[model samples]
Target: MDITGERASESLMEDTTTEGSTMVIKMECTDDQPQMRENQEEVEKLKALLAQKEQENDLLREKIQTCQAPYPLTPETINNSSVPNYFRYCTGFTYDEFNKLCRFLRLPDSETVTQTHIPLNCDKLDRHTRHMPLRQEFLLVLIRLRQNFDLEELAFKFQIDIQSVSTLFSLWIDFMYDRLGVSVWPHRDIITKNMPDDYKAEFPTSFAILDCTEIKIEKPSSLLVQCEIYSNYKSTNTLKSLIVCDPRGSIMFASALYTGSTSDQEIFRECKIKDLLKGLLQCGYLKRGDGLMVDKGFLIEKDAKELGLKLNIPPFAKSSLRMPVSDVEITKKIAKHRVHVGRAIAKVKQFKIVSGRIPNSMLVNINEIWFVVCMLSNFQQHIIQT
Candidate 1:
């Protein structure tokens, strides 16, 4: 009995040792649980951050691809492909003619031209890298005027963003107007020398063809502005200018833009054509008998007489059903000659930007744009022959 009791005590001791060891292991696991959880949480956070960074990297790569040139061009490509395409699509000049005009206008090559040379007052150039060469930029502006392409369309063609296209257009328009607009008007002696034979024979003293041309514009949101710009003749909102051309249909003078509500007679008066004529006459550039060929809308005969100028106007119906046959014949003859003024206006309108209704966004520069378009028209072949 004593032996059995001793064996039972030893087994109990072994059981106690095993239970104590298991308790120690459980305590250790409890102590490590919070640290393990923190480690797991940190791993999850790092994984999430890695995924986010990877996504950002992918976006940056895509942007880089988009910014790459869509149509790469070397000098050969520019001369061979781009020049001809631009000539046909926008400038209406042959490659050689375009180059000549660029030279005459003092336009610098895109590669060499500094950003400071662009005439816009805004900081648009700071927004993006200059992806286009200056030559391409010049062509882009000319094409925009010639075709009146939407900004998006021009962006796609030029492989640039729309904002860049718009900025380039604005800057180039300003440049062209500043550089070339003043050159459009030649001296009165030049006009006399370039007079067509038909004009010289029929009206030897005719100095210029006088007319008011209208360019339709976006309807204004303000009722007052709409009323002021609305034209009864065109039945649309418009801006009007007094365009004077030599007998050969070359524009010699373009007045400041006026509200369409202004009458042709009023535009002539407000534009100070009389003052300009007076100056020319006093300078001995024009003779006292030198005259302006005009349509009936110009009722400045009295003003012309006071200025020592003649108004070659067609006969008016005043209150009669018809005029004398001689007056009718004279009207026909005046109309025949005056038709060239309309043709000259058409040449200016060939630039669809002027021919079509101008967007309100563009109204701020409409005067300059109008002047530039008229000047550019002179770069084309003569609208009339001698």
Candidate 2:
């Protein structure tokens, strides 16, 4: 121990004799070593922190993509993974029928078929966001009677712009109506081909059951337009349509749409549903006592008699000298049997597509839409019965 102490004292003494001091050298070495180690450790920690933040940011971005707009999640629920499934896809109609109808209408298809430089703007959205073809989930909801939804619920379901839903509906109404309307009306050839065998035995002259229903319309901007559409029954602005149903309440014919201001008789005259009936009669496609049962509003006794078509009208008070009591009683029975028409109308409006006040943009398409709904009702009822 004594020798070691003597050596350390000599070494200290020798270093002290040099130009620079040993204590100064020792202090500089100690300061630089700790600082360099701390800086390296800090840089590694900063890189880890930056990587963690980057990962968190990527996670946040994905959540934002699926988040509901204008219905921000609370802080507690932001990271929760148990969101409800709401958005529905279109799969109601049979694939065969849907594709056939699309082809029939000449609508463009995104599947397996490409056209070069087609000059049409039929696609509702552009390619960047067009992961799926234009889908009407709202209409499918109605057609399928999906119970878990309402208009507001669907606004979040599809991640679609709300106003865009309304626009899409109007456009679809036009497309469907135009396609099905013509088919519903009985062509002379079709009427001959599908005539009931028993019609010749009982009522050989019966063509179709005619009735009217008022669909509510949004109040017009002008008072004149308001007065024109206002119906006395509902005491609201409504558009009236004439539906001519077959015996089972399937609408076989529909009048062209007219302003609510037009009287039922006037609409008949102007739009030529009556003229078409007369033409059918002239061609022997329709015969008289071919029982024409109409509501009291259309009390055209002479025309019915001249057309060789038997008119069944309800009993009016003695003061109104239009038709005999016998005719009224016969009409009453026909009306009773025809109440199914009202029931058919009720079934049709149950579809929310037609239940609401239709958009003004779709007014032109209403007639065709009416026919399509009727056909669907008939098709559904047939399916149910069979």
Candidate 3:
């Protein structure tokens, strides 16, 4: 093939000659222009086909890489990092906080690790070993709670199955609740020492700020269950939890989830926070005059009196919607100081799992999840300044 896109077939011949004798030579050239053109096209088609096969091979390699888990989390990978806040990126815990949690939730015993696999959120019990590292298991739980990743998403990321993800979360959440929940009830000294100046000046003896925070939950199929949990105030099905904060705005208490239909005052009475207050007073964590800061709707003045504690509640005007100037000022002061409680609740809600409307299946462990988030919130920086 030449520049003219034609092939030239040349025939050469030489006349026989003795040594040192000159020889006569003849040359003939034949060009099959059309056949050469067809051969050129065929060669080009072969080249294109080769390139296409190479590209297909490259794509096959990429798909293979995608199928394998190259970087399932390991402690060495997290700790040997060059970047700051890498731990926080993975599990929303600073390095110090992560280490602190490691200290608190020490590696569970074999009994703690052996969770019942039947009838959880998964189908079959995968007794076959998929040995995820303990820290990675902890990280998986945090990621699910903090980021609210579904079972499939977590299973893929951590190189496990959906059943393992469910079982691990249930096991770890309950373990965390048991370990951390017991000590979350604030000590009298912690609250008093951390109380802010505003509380000191306005309500100096304030024991705690009380409020009912509601978490939206899936509507149950059973109408009776629905009726039990439906909340007129939230205008949806929800579970109510009593979250109390000290004056400094750290969560002092987070009660278990109750029916949304439960009144705030009813929750207040039944949750036995007042009983704890009595114990605190008996233990000298509180004095008789140290009262709970609450909204007017929290009608437990009689209970407070029975426990020998005062109620720093706002006055209600019967005849008119106006109150005396002193009464209004007192109410304003209570409202102003109670803002930290709302901020404390907001901190707990930052964990989107408990903050958002939870699935119906989660109702079983919702209390533990809520308690864990509340307990974890206390480990973060203060919700209010001293």
Candidate 4:
């Protein structure tokens, strides 16, 4: 009996020891699994953070490239090159027109706060010195008209600071874009008078012509913006502006500011040009059979069809080299009629503000300048017609 009892006790002790060992193993295994899961989660989080940083870095790199790129016309290059004279002729500004503009702008002999204690009606805004030499001010104005001046050359030729030239430019451009921007389409009464007699008698269905022009800008620091602003034609950084012209070729409409990167199709949508066109239509001015001529880039065929309006485009020539006889004939006739819009575009570009490459500035006030120029163009055209 004693021997049997001892054997059973020893078996019971062994079973307890086995249970203890199993509990320790299970606890260790559970703890290890949680640690492994935690490590994996940490690794995933680090990867996400890394990707985010890379994206930010890419954006920053693009920004840097846009800002640091060199402008085409340095002061030295402009003084030496024939480009300035070419610009003057293309822009249609004679010495007389230049002087007249100076007088109109109140540029020459406008009392500067620094020159005298004379407080004119004008108050200073940024506390930046508005006291520039009259020549410098004139040069700056000319820049707005001729946009191709060598800032460095102007500084050297006129003996003024380049920064002053740049500051005046930025300020004036802002003024032009914001304050002087004209409507995309004039009121019905205004356009009705100018409609061609034949068209008024017959179809009475003509409205406006639309086109886009590229303006160069200084390189941006951002690579993305740089890539965006770089146009194939200019082979430089540029912004695209959309202009709408009346039958007389006077700009009835101009768009708000857009980056150089914007495409014509995107700009049309972004600027809501359709809204302006609709306004003219709703006013009962533009009829179903009315027509507009546009370059291929406008991509407005669908809209024209829906509106029951005719669009005149020179048919794409079969051979890239020679235009079809029908296409040539139509193009020549259209060009003659569309001369007013061309002239208007030419006048707007005359304001040095629209002439050359502009800097990638966030605060360009182009709308006001656009309006003022339109008003001027209207005034000038009437004078010429008379």
Best by TM-score: 1
lDDT (Cα, tens digit) per residue for candidate 1, span 35-85: 999999999999999999999998886565435434443232445763446
Candidate 1 vs candidate 2: the TM-score winner is 1
Q: What global local distance difference test value does model 4 have?
A: 0.60
Q: Deviation in angstroms for 99 in model 2?
A: 9.1
RMSD for each of the candidates? 7.5, 11.6, 15.9, 21.6
Per-candidate TM equals 0.75, 0.58, 0.73, 0.53
Candidate 3 lDDT by residue in tens digits, 1-386: 67444322221122224321342222111245667898999999999999999999988865554343243665557767888867676666776787677667775423123223222222333533233345567778888888899999988877777887888898778778878866455666677677777677777677688989999988888999999999999999999989888888888788888999999889988887877777877977777777788887788888888988888888887685668899988888988988888899998888889888899888787888999998888777787767
Q: How large an RMSD does model 3 have?
A: 15.9
Query: After superposing candidate 1, which stretches have Cα over 4 Å from the reference?
Result: 1-86, 109-113, 116-123, 127-131, 318-322
For each candidate in the order shown, give its overall lDDT on alpha carbons.
0.78, 0.57, 0.76, 0.60
Q: Which residue runs does candidate 4 get wrong by more than 4 Å?
A: 1-179, 182-184, 187-192, 195-204, 257-262, 317-328, 361-376, 382-386
For model 4, residues 1-386, the per-residue Cα lDDT tens digits are 69999999999999999999999999899889989999999999999999999999988765553333223332233345666554244334444454465465444443231312222212432223344333334444445454455668655544446776555555555544443454445655566677766434532445777777776678889888778777776787876777777766667677765666677778877787777667767777565666877775667777777667788755666665888787787776666555656667787766665566565453355555544555455434331131
The stretch of ten residues in a row with the least summed lDDT in candidate 2 is 70-79
For 1-386, candidate 2 gives per-residue lDDT tens digits of 69999999999878777636766787899889989999999999999999999999987765554232222221123223254322212222333444444565565554322212132233664332222233232233233332324445555554555554444445555555656656455544454344445432344455566677778777878988888787887787787777777655667766665666667666655666667678877876676556665777866667667767776556565665667777766666667646756877786676555678766765666676666666555544321121
lDDT of 3 at 96: 77
Judging by TM-score, tell me the better candidate of 1 and 4.
Answer: 1
* Model 2, residue pairs in steric clash: 177-368, 205-290, 206-290, 288-308, 288-309, 289-310
- Per-residue lDDT of 32 in model 1: 100
